[model samples]
Each structure stands twice: as C-alpha cells, then as structure tokens.
Target: MFNLFGRSRKSNLRPPRAPGDTVRAKDLAYLQKWSASRAGVEGFVEPETIVNEMSVVFVDGTGEWTRRRIGGPKGIDAVFQGTGVPLYFAEETGYPQRMRDRIEKDRIVRERLKQRERRARLEQERER
Candidate 1:
C-alpha cells in the first residue's frame, strides 16, 4: 500500500520558502538610507508571485538603482510613507528609460573589458 508519488497525509501542499526569502528590518533600513542619499529617487512597487516575494526598485536621477524585498504590497506604503519619492506600480508604467539606458551602458562596458582581456591573452600566446 505504499504510494511513492502521492502526497503525505501531513503535507500542506505549499512550496517551501527558501532561506533569506522573508523580508528583514535591515531591508527597510537599507532602502531608507540609500534613498536618502540619492537625489530624485523614485520607488516602483513590484508585485509578489509564486516564484518571488514582493519587492521594490528605487531609481535615482542618474539611473542608478537598487532592489529589495518589501515583504508585501502594504510594505510599499510603509517604506515610502513620509519620503518624497514617488511610488508607482511597475506593472502599470513599466521601468523608466533611464534605467534601461544605464543597464545597456554597463553591459557595453563589461563587454569591452572582456574583449581587452581576451586580446591580452592572445598576445601572450603569440609571444611564447
């Protein structure tokens, strides 16, 4: 009568939460400090999903950004309650163009560095 593919009687049927998946006080504190230090910072609320927890992305005027878990949707208000940074649902407006530009810029820079390293290695082989 053993069923290897069936759920156990005690099973709750919920996916197990990974370690560090839950939000912590330091998450809020880090967001606060990072936002305070940056100018023209804005917050975008990202909804929770089966694969990931609710989180927020803060982008500054220069397109520099950071993301952190906010526990839930309500945590968005709690984090930016008094702060001047505007909050927007990422699902509605989508990410800003500047953020995308910054990402592209970074990617190009990394590719150039990798190319230079490869050239140096080839030169070393040629010299041998």
Candidate 2:
C-alpha cells in the first residue's frame, strides 16, 4: 500500500508496543472514574501470566467487578492511591469465588444465547 505522499505503508511503520508501555490518559481517567463511582471496593493486582497480561481488578462487596490492564505493580499502586480501599496481590490471595462464579455464569449465558441464535437461523433456513 502507498500513502498520498507517495510513501509505502511499510516505510511509515511505528514501533510495537511493549508490555511496559505507558498507559493512555483516557484509560487513567476511566480508572479514576470507575473507582470513584464505587463506595467500597477492593483492588487486586494480578501479575502477567502466560494466558493474560498484568491487570488490576476491582471488586465490590456485591461481587460486581471491573478489570483493566495496568502497566505494572507500581502503576497499580499509583492508580489506586486515592481510593481508600485495600489492594492485594492476586498471586498471594486468590481471586474471590464470587468473581469466578460470575464469570462462569456470564460465559454460560453467552453460550446459551449463541445456541438459541443458531437454532433460529437453522429454522429460518429450513422454512426457506
């Protein structure tokens, strides 16, 4: 591909983002907003594993949770400094069972919805 300036797209390549790349301003703002919206919540810092990148997960007493990718442990601390909630290392303290159950339930609901949609499509094809 070529650009209007007559330069090939490959020539205008940008550097790939690393795991420790700086967090975006919008993401920081969102994190602040989400934490402020909750009255009581706990933050969990999860280290980067094979399956997932480093992230921070916030959970309230009612099991409602929000997760976002953070830069690292230092970034996690800096982000949640204003929130007067406890932060824990997920490696030491496993995620709450409620969060796990909620994830599973959501997965099951999505699968069921997909199955229903597939059946509906099959029925429509049969009618045609």
TM-score of each: 0.80, 0.68
Expressed as tens digits, the lDDT of each residue in 28-109 for candidate 1 is: 7788889999998989988877666788899999999999877775576677774557889999999999999999999999
Local distance difference test values of all predictions, in order:
0.79, 0.72
lDDT of 2 by residue, 1-128 (tens): 99899988765563332255533456567777877787667888887654455677888766678887665555665666645557888889988887788788889999999999999999999999
Q: Point to the candidate with the largest lDDT.
A: 1
Which residue window of length 10 is worst by lDDT in model 2? 14-23
RMSD of each: 4.3, 6.5
After aligning candidate 2 to the native by TM-score, how far in Å is the CA of 108 from where it should be?
A: 0.7
Q: Count the backbone clashes (under 3 Å) in each candidate.
A: 0, 0
| Model 2 misplacement above 4 A | 1-24, 49-53
